[model samples]
Target: MNKSRIFRTLLGIAIVSAVPTLAHAQKANWQNLDLKSDSTFGISTEKAYKELLKGKKSVKVIVAVNDGGVEATHEDLKRIMWVNTKEKPGNGKDDDKNGYIDDINGWNFIGGPKESVNFETLELTRLVRRDQARFANTTDANVAEKDKKDFEAFKAERAELEQKLAEAKENLAGITGFKTALDAVVQKIGKENPTAEDFKNFKPSTAIEGRIQGILIQQLEKGSFKDFYEDQIKEGLDYYTRQAEYNLNLDYDPRSIVGDDPNNDKERFYGNNDVAGPDAMHGTHVAGIIAADRTNKIGILGVADNVAIMGVRCTPNGDERDKDVANAIRYAVDNGAKVINMSFGKAYSWNKAVVNEAMKYAASKDVLIVQAAGNENKNIDVENNFPNHKDLDEKTIASWITVGASGPKDDETLKASFSNYGKNQVDVFAPGVQIYSTVPGSKYKSLDGTSMASPVVAGLAGLIRSYYPKLTAAQVKEIIVKSVTKVNHNVEYAKGEGPDAEKVSVPFSDLCISGGIVNAYNALKLAATYSGKSVAK
Candidate 1:
């Protein structure tokens, strides 16, 4: 691909097949399986729960999920929702006086008194808008020496944003046309939801009909045709529409509802108490992966049982603001959150200094920040992902762990194709592809991204903190990083650009800092050794 096309593709989320196999067998939740007995790619949570935590006393550990939003009232999450005991519900007052009013569940920074901002511009777009007027005609002679660097950065971002906007418009037009034709074929078939057998048995009367039939058949061979049409395509259309209308629009400003100074770092506490904002699918899934009800028997079991999930709504559907992220971290830390799981990221940050200060504050309060290594399928060492652990001076925070995604099969294709990796930046790898977790409306579904992998590690961190209450945040991070199950072999990884991409053999260990996948059982053993606790023989 060319430079423009590469930038366009990277702007969107990377979607990869979770299960690369062709067989239509009932899939197992291999992410939670015990590798010792199941011989599958998993974190071994079952083994740790049955063997090590059988007779152990549990302690309540609070894990703050800082994402778009979380359905705290979901069937699997209601009982485990972190309640603010100090503050009374619906009293119209700050009962606890912790800089928030009526934070019974948590606080939402992206919403106002009555409305929530669902979509916002990307960081790059925001930067372009802010500096375009000042740097539009900047020259070496005209621009001040101090402002020359910022002017150059603004020019680069504006160029990239313009290219991405053009590509999004073109892609949206193509998909819209395709959807219209597919709807006509569906109408001709006289079935709103057609099965694979129906498509196979239908007699094509024209070349377009035959071509549509072939496409549907090929898609059905991978998974459900219904899901491919209703969920994937529909969501893709919405994503592209949003990208064109909101993400790339320089005139769009969703921060007016919050009614705060976006550039001010000292201003804090200016949002409403609606923690579970308009969309809660992503945050709800992350929360379920960490602490869904295990004994309810309604949905799948979460990794930890003694976890109180504190929902801090900071991220919107688009790129999250740096000011909100900084406040969210401080809010979680001040509200007794031991582990904060941040499942959202972007390519650029307008105010990284404030975020770094918040991270420093979290570390000072003994809070560990677990972040997702982005799903760009590119090394993060060369590319930039915002809200990271690295400070401006290139020093990393001690209580942070950056997680990458891993796949099911433990062979040459062990690493997830869509997962972003860096030996120095990403701390560990976990199961992220096709993770079945809780969604909105008390439902469960499978989603893929490094966003899913971050919570798996966060849940394990919560588990260790619950069992070993004396372990510091830094110690917990160290134990998780050091206890990874090393995969020392060459794997066929997807390389090169789009369409021309090919599988190339590379050592899996070089992808991440731990050089292995995370194992809950191994983490538990290491925790026991660190805390001097005896394990079951």
Candidate 2:
């Protein structure tokens, strides 16, 4: 569920549109605009900066982006990257003696002494590979009492993998058949890219041809045949193919490259200094959303202006390891990061104990942790999501914010179509749909998911911390939570997908704890007045 939603495309817009709606779906820097002023459901970031934080003296705050990897050298991002003044650049030694060598920006646990891991099997697949040795040959009655839970879990994982593989293959077959049919019709049309007019002018000789023409004509009304084929069909092929080839592949193992003991949660300090790993796109976009250079005059302005981005590369194309995530959190806190942004999550965990220890460590340091509520569209209160603030002892972190995605409108689409929500679990909602930000290679692109939503809250957290340096991490969370723009209307919540998708009119209060979307203008106003618990910076 984690990696499957990470690289989701905007092809859904192009596929259903009458002409191409891809360009229309994107609104540049809409997340930072004022909702009332701009008629978009944004964070009102610009209003806060102009009214509350414009001339205020502030201190620099480091916000760690704990995700795939970040493009630190991006045109707008390079100047604001957290530089390790204690370490000498490109040297072989740990100048600061922090265990990590030459960590100019941050650390990458995904990397080892030689190279980094790009593709990894899902946690279910990893569990299968590990537990299959002991439980594969055993039956329900043959297992010992102590090993019963593990044996049952192994069985469940194996069954899930089988089902996933079957579904992937079935979806792949459907897409392939559709592509074959589409190609045949395109060949008959004799046009590289057909339009609605072309489809209407050419008469269908057969029933299948007529059906194909009808479908293609609806698509061409908003997009071209090329757009429909590439966005809808090819994207599906890639997704299902990846599920079969890498994510669900039990034989594939990429952990040996890291050369660390997966069972040893006590083991730390075993990764390389290459924060920008093989895939920096996700993390780079996350960093930009949090604090892209505000005055760069090169690209879009980030939510926060004066802040340092600490790139802690932990997440990859797949579910992040708990050991790596724990280490990443400790490293960021130890390296002077006051706020950490986690944009990736999964439904399973390999080792929650280590991750719990790291969360406690971060909490002790008064660092606010902000994480996405995931893109699964399932309520976390009923479903499972890993790396949550709750520890092994069931004690939740005091300075944690769980964010859900909201769109650019205050209507039914206000809550993003794919956002996960819970009245008790999720803290607030933020702009996450088609958010434009810095990508790898000094480029930029718009991406969707709660991954984008977490950074928006993280940016606002950084902004508050920078301006109100005396506020504790808990107080910062309090201000952000108590100062939201309340929504008082009923949203037509779709319970399922497609024709069977029932649109239930539910009050926005049932979505998340805050019962509203995040507003920087309101949060800053509350932060200025909030002084219950104070800390010296």
Candidate 3:
């Protein structure tokens, strides 16, 4: 067989293996529909808006979406964006004197006047780099007793970076080779966009060609060959390449562009005014889930109609810095954001103290913070995910609620396979699997992750605060946790890693603190009762 034909066969096998298996159940827009009436696993926001909130007076609530960035000009999001009235738009001045210049919408902590930091080194990599002098040459004899833990951490992180770098290089090579082979096939076929029929009709005399044909036919059943190879494969190759070049590169320093002391948490006011930075897909999806325009009839309705989304861009494609996260929290709190949605988390936290202090500040200001419980599929009670509600001494933050993703089905796979669960760490479950929300440029997509789940809870908090203005952030957190729809049935818990990992039967209630999924109607009812207010029946 020819070398090109063999490569094509290998490429076909690689592509087929990479494709995710389709779920047996049909896809449903269950996240937006009423759970009670529609028999879907939703928060019942539709029912709440239709039945309970008919004549209720709503107060405008500002929600801070502290993620990558947000599309302030998005058709469904523009009208509902929180504008800094005190600051002058288009004028190069810190009119509000809040330190950020021209921050008419919000602020971007990961960008500067001329540049934006999209991909960055992980926290672990940074930590290893920072402590290189102290731990690099020190052995057990020379290492100080107090520095023992730091030394151990440094060693572990170094090993992790080395392993990750090797893996990323391997992945990049494989993806690049596959793409080249795919391009060769396309050229040989003499089609810019080859279809399944074309591949099927083409007579393959060689064994390798026959194998390639079979693989293409299999993939075409799921999606078009052009889409699979051009879009998905290209994206994978780019991601792996970036991971090898930036994320695992110990010498890489993308933070210098921001020009802020990352170690100094007190240096809070140093980021640019471009809230919607280079990438806003993640943040826009999160913001739309919380407060998309409801009356526009253009996109899907948001969880809270009377909300003004404030974009405080901090998170990047890689893990967010603790200093930026802390500053983002303070900015949101100072700018009158009652609810802060953090749809991001990382395994390691280099400066947990600073982030905790910021969380305390938000708590003091009575601002509710909803964080994703992470998508690692691990029990977070044992393993840690950063920016959690718990303090170093194990005291929980009153204003914080960590959310896990829940699927549409109420059966064995009730909890999302990728969702991180914990009876202690994770507060509640929410609709996150295949959640349809607005992305960048006014487009809508169904993305899965606990990142999506956190915003669902954040939107609920926004809704509760909007109707019941008297309730404190702590009270809102309590209402959300206390009003979830309890699910006592057993669920198929993820036993290992990946989609095809073995699943073990575990009770759904054991997955989270609330032992239930968040319900908007129940939360609203609880809010009304707690505040001694009447709702429209």
lDDT values for all models: 0.82, 0.83, 0.81
Error of 3 at 29 (Å): 4.6
lDDT for each residue of candidate 3 in 382-403, tens digit (9 for 90 to 100): 8878977666332236688999
lDDT: the better of candidates 1 and 3: 1
- Write the residue-wise lDDT of candidate 2 on 417-441 in tens digits: 7788888889999998878889988
Runs of candidate 1 with Cα error greater than 4 angstroms are 1-28, 137-146, 203-208, 392-396, 532-537
> Ranking under TM-score, best-scoring first?
1, 2, 3
lDDT ranking, best first: 2, 1, 3
The clash count of every prediction, one per candidate, is: 0, 6, 0
Candidate 1 structure quality by residue, lDDT tens digits, 1-537: 000001212113321222322234224466788666887788999888898889899899999999988998999999999999999899899988898999999999998977988888888888899898877778768998899788778778889999999977887776676677678888888888887777888788877678778777766776776676755456656767888999999989989888888878788979988888998889999999998998787887899989999999999878998889999999999999999999878899888888998988888898989999888788887788887655533223668999898877788877877788888889999998778888999988777778989999999999999999888888888889889989988877667667568878888888988899999999989898877532221
Better of 1 and 3 by TM-score: 1
* TM-score of every model versus the real structure: 0.93, 0.92, 0.91
TM-score of 3: 0.91
Q: Distance from true position, residue 70, model 2, in Å?
A: 0.8
Residue 28 CA displacement from its true place in model 2, Å? 1.7
Best by lDDT: 2
On lDDT, the stronger of 2 and 3 is: 2
lDDT of 1 at 300: 78
Pairs that collide in candidate 1 are none
